[model samples]
Structure formats: C-alpha cells, structure tokens
Target: MFKKLDFFLFGWIINWMYPEYYRPKYGYQRYYILFFHYLIPQKLFRLNPKVRWPVHFTSKVLAAENIKKGILCDPGDNNNNYIQANNGIIFGSNIELGPGVSIISSNHKGNNLREHTKGKPITIGNNVWIGANSTVLPEVSIGNNVIIGANSLVSKNIPSNSVAVGNPCRVIKPKEDYSEDLSVIIFNKKIVEKFDVFLNSNV
Candidate 1:
C-alpha cells in the first residue's frame, strides 16, 4: 500500500541520512530496521499522522485515536511503562511524562470479570509535566501548565497553573509559588530544595 511505501521510504531516508547514530543500549539500530519494525504501524499512520512520533519504541500506547500531540512518555527505572486510554484521551501539545507514569482512562465497574467495564475520557492540556510513578485515574482532566509530584495519585480534575501532590493528590499551592528547581530539576534536588524551602519560609 501507499502507506507502507511511505513508511519504508521515510525509514530509508532516515537510515541513509544518519546511519552511525544508532544506540543499542536504549534499543536503536543503525539501518532504521528497528524504527520501522518496532513502530506501531497503525498508530504511526493514524489520522493526522505527521504530528509526532513516540520517544521510545518500547512504550505501549493503547487507543491512539484518543491521543493528541507532543507527548513525552518515557520508561521507568524498572522500564516498560504503559499508557492506556480505552474510552477517550486527548492530550494537548508539549506534555512531558516521566518514568513509571501511568494514565488509565478506563476501569472495572464491578468485581465481575465478565462484566463490562466503565470508562471516561481524560484530557491533559499543554505544558503539563507529570512526575515519575504517578497514576492518573479515569475522567480526570488536567489543565495546562500543571506539575504533578512523583509517586502521587491523581483522582480528580486539576485546574491550570497548579502544583498537586500526595496520595489523594490535593493541590499543594499555586505553581508560581513552586521553585523552578523543584518543578523542572529532577535529579538529586528533591531533598535539598524541600529542606531549603522549609527553612526559608519558616524563617
């Protein structure tokens, strides 16, 4: 088909252009073989196909029709993270998802295995950053410019420009109050910044 040809041609062009930059540790090949092979072909050629490409080939995204642009779904420390959107999930541009983040749009209605499950749509706005090990339940609409802390569970809708944390995921404060180091700086900064902020605010 024309789609297949298109994919192959694109892959070939990529292979021809950058043959030496393949990485094996994170799983990439020099010949663009892995790119075309591991790609979810159906997801790649979906409606408005030219929008974006997933960062990792190992990531599993269900119901691509429900997804939108500029999503960064990365693997966890354990590797192999999942994003499942059964009913409907719409994502705006430039949303960054850290490792071990799970966004589930459908859940079981009852204990019965055979019974039909219930689902609701999840819409995440642009410039939102979800931290590692966070789980987003169904029917949750996360607004734009939001930052979710690591190991948090989001059960309800979060308004734009907020910082939410904890098990039930309450809004801690407005995002403007949060330090840029806390929101954007990921590694080896959590403990020191929190302590520093506590000290400064208390003083």
Candidate 2:
C-alpha cells in the first residue's frame, strides 16, 4: 500500500514541477512522461548526457553527454536496447527513433572486446525518422528529411531527402521525386504567384 502511495506522490511532484509536459500532443509523449518522469528516484538525482527540454526516452541510455534535443527513442524490449556512444553522437531536432533501434557509435577491434576501434561521430540530421528494429552502425552521418525503413541496417552514410531501406539500407527514392504530384497551392494569391515563379525557376 505504501509503494502505491509513493508512486502516486512521485507522479504528482513531477507533474507539479514540470507543468509544460502537459502540452505534448503526440501519443508517444505519454510514454515519455511515464518513463522519464518515473525514472527519477528523487528530484536531485541528476546525471550527465544533459538532455534538453522535451526529449523523451523509453529505455536506458549510455553516454548521455552525446545526446541532443528533440530525440524520441523507444527500445521495444527495454531489456536488450543498448545505445553505445564511445565516440560521440549528435541528434538534430524532431528526430524520431522507432522501437528496438540501436545507435552504436563505436565497435570493438578484431576479436578483442577490450579495445575499441576508431570511429567518427554519428550525426543524425533534423527531421530524420529511423524505423523500428533498425541498427545504426558507427561513423555514419544521416542527413536531413530522411526515412529509414524497418529492420534496416544503416552501415553507410545516408544522403539528405531520401527514403532508404533493406539490410544494407539503400536509397530507393529521393524526397523530391515523391512530391511531383503536389502541383496545386492553397495560399494567398501573392504567395502562390511567388511559389509558381519559384517552381518555374527550378525547372
């Protein structure tokens, strides 16, 4: 009975302390509220990784210093989700990480598990959506407005404005190619005229 009472009190305190958390409109934001808020044993147990406001994590994370703002991650199993950042990692704004996704920034050298191989920083650009069950390997930089399909393995750097999929994660289509059908504009006449001019200029 005391444990349940304690849990409620903890929730009340977090809700009272961070009132802005009430404004999130996404379904997954509930998961963020539940996990991050509850993960805190007390209001004073602060650590590194220096997470900015509005970021959410549904699983355990290592090397919190490497994480940036606007990252949403959910490790499906929660037990096996391992985020490794031996080098460094930079996440841009509005980046959504699907369930069971692993972003590894370093790898072990040869058969030895003690020594790690040299690797570059993993930089994920803004508006990138990594699908479920995907693994982003070391030294990879994903560009902006990219979508990686489910169960894909990102071994190489992915370019901006592309949809990549499969085991090796190949770009099947560019973002511009998918927008050819959007010919109509519903805006002010002046803005629409300017937009038309811009489109013609590109052509």
Candidate 1 per-residue lDDT over residues 24-46, each given as its tens digit: 22112322343453333314544
Residue 126 Cα positional deviation in candidate 2, in Å, after optimal superposition: 0.5
- Give the Å shift of residue 109 in candidate 1: 3.0
Residues 1-203, model 2: lDDT tens digits: 54445445554554454332222222233433444553352233542223323222344456656654332222222333456777888775446677778889888888898988876789887567888889999999999779999999999999999999999999999875323222332211123232344333322
Query: lDDT (CA) for every model shown?
Result: 0.57, 0.59
In terms of lDDT, which candidate is strongest? 2
Query: Could you tally the backbone clashes for each prediction?
Result: 0, 2
TM-score of 2: 0.62
lDDT of 1 at 129: 84
For each candidate, what TM-score against the reference?
0.58, 0.62
Segments in model 1 whose C-alpha atoms lie over 4 Å from true places? 1-52, 55-57, 70-79, 114-116, 177-203
